[model samples]
Target: MPTHVVFIHGLWIHSAAWKPWQDLFEEKGYATSAPGWPGDRETVEETRANPDGLDNQGIAEICHHYADIIAGLDEKPIVVGHSFGGLIAQELLANDLVAAAVAIDPAPIKGVKVLPFAQLRSGFPVLGNPANKSRTVALTEKQFKYAFGNVLTDEESDALHAAWTIPGPGRPLFEDATANFVRNSPAAVNTHTAVRGPLLLTSGTEDHTVPESVTLAVVKLYADNTASVTDYHRYEGKGHSLTLDDGWKDVADDVLAWLAAQEL
Candidate 1:
């Protein structure tokens, strides 16, 4: 059987956003699917209309939801994720649940001590309000531009916001923010000793949501693990919207090339 790939999306973006990616991967001779989070509706409109299902959804629950989906695959598939989905990809790989993983602009896992100002600003929409921990939050067009499309043209940024943005559960952001203080935090990943499959972590240099410095810290956390492969790639001038914007193909093609180099 051809190698299978599972694409996991992050907060505020519906699973349907991955359709172009899925199509591209399939055309390249791989079987692919983009599965939504547990409570996600089938379409962007549907998800936007009824986002309460995602309220209070935390990191552990999201990880478990994807784990269950991976369990049913005939063979361990490669996982590719963005944002919180990137965090889930790492967790699943660390658990030996996937053949390999590519985390694009991933959220900071536990042990990441560098909290850049941009990251803080990006998360402020939820973190600014204590009550958001159990609620769902939506990003305004301005907020989306700042957090995800800062490097894109206003026209392109607004188009993406209108097409893909959805309500995101605030719980994961809350959990990630407090991960260092919480014991056995769900945002934690086993980066030190897991002799698992290869991992490729990518970052956009201009990413306001997850700055390159933050991803660099995560690379350091795995520095002791010489037994496993952990590669880092930096894309200059790219932003958090690298996975969904018009330039998404460049990022996707890079991932495809990396996977090919790994012979996966």
Candidate 2:
């Protein structure tokens, strides 16, 4: 049977945004699926029209949703995720639920001490309001441009915002922000002792939402864990929109090459 691969999307982007990625992976002889988060609709329009289902959803809920999906699959599959989905990818891998994982510009997991100002500014849309913890928040075009498309051209950024952005639950942001102070936080990943499959963590140098410094810090957290493979890739001048912008294919091709190197 062909190796199965699952694509997990991050906040404010519909799973449909992974269609190009799914198509490319399938052509490479892999069976792929991009499942939405627990309450996501089948398409971007539907999701944007009715985002109330996502309200109050937290990290643990999102993790379990994907875990359940993985359980139903015929075999363990590789998971590639962005943003919070990237954080979930790490959680699933740490728990041995997937064959491998690629976390692109993933949110900072627990134990990370460096919080860049850009990251804070990026998250302020939700973090600025405490009540947002139980609500769904939508990003304005300006906010989306700042957080996800800062490095892209105005035309490209506006098009992406119109095509793919959606309301995101604020709960996960709250949970991640306080993860360091909370016991058994859902945002925590087992980076220290998991002898699991190989993992690749990528970051865009100009990413405002998840700065390179943050991803670099995550790489360091896993440095002592020589028992497993942890690789880091840096894409200079790319931003948080690296997975959806016109340059997405470049990032996707690199992931394909890396997977080939791993013989996966």
Candidate 3:
């Protein structure tokens, strides 16, 4: 079987962040695609210049974008997502588009509780202001360190900061924290109930954004597979930025190993 892989990136990041993972998966004979969020720029410089480019788009639009891609595929792809992308993966699975999926330190999808200190703090910049709901909020160096750069060296963190970090639409975060997230979205409640394919949840031990508590909370929402088919793994000394941090390759290796075991 030819397994394709689709990577859905989280908020504040474009699809480019998945380049390393895409390269790895494609080399193994799996096809790959990392579709951009609506109005997203093609490059980091362009992203910085037009941070609001994707602001007009909503979760429903983005979800449908991935769904369209999946519907066109000859074979179902193994979907991988982190943070907001994780939520998207669950949405994709709910739509029965992928064969298997892994969500890494994914953002909460309504009803899934546990507001970690880190997640709260990381979101404070935007959540504090009502006006931010329709605007793009940029991360300060400190915010970046606490949220995404904690696991990397200062140099590596600086490099990452310089290369790709940009402002993001605060509306989605607000949305996730408020209304529809709780009552409407497909991933509104634990994904295990809807997920038929193999699912692996990876949490970073040091991550505050999607802390271990949050990951476990998500696992509990699953109504079936109590025999532990839904594998949950935690990596020590890692942060929410596990997929983009210096040791990202190791994290990717673990994901690949799990996917391989499923033989998808």
How well does candidate 2 match the true structure, expressed as C-alpha RMSD?
A: 0.6
Instruction: Estimate, for each residue in 1-264, the C-alpha lDDT of model 3 and write its tens digit.
Output: 567899988877667888999999888788888887766788877987987776745677778888888889898888999988888887777667778778898777766667878788888888999888887877777777778888777787767777767778877788777733355754463454464677788888888677778888777766464533577888999987788877899999899888878886
TM-score of each: 0.99, 0.99, 0.92
In order, what is each prediction's RMSD in angstroms? 0.6, 0.6, 2.1
Please report, as a residue range, the 10-residue window in candidate 3 with the lowest summed lDDT: 186-195
Q: lDDT per residue, candidate 2, 66-178, as tens digits?
A: 99999999999999999999999999999999999999999999999899899999999999999999999999999999999999888999999999988999999999999
User: What is candidate 1's lDDT per residue for 1-264, written digit by digit as tens?
Assistant: 999999999989988999999999999999998989989999999989999999899999999999999999999999999999999999999999999999999999998998999999999999999999998999999999999999999999999999999999999999999999999999999999998999999999999999999999999999999999999999999999999999999999999999999999
In order of listing, the candidates' clash counts read 0, 0, 0
The list of candidate 2 runs beyond 4 A from truth reads: none
lDDT of 1 at 224: 97
Q: How many Å off is the CA of 187 in candidate 3? A: 4.8
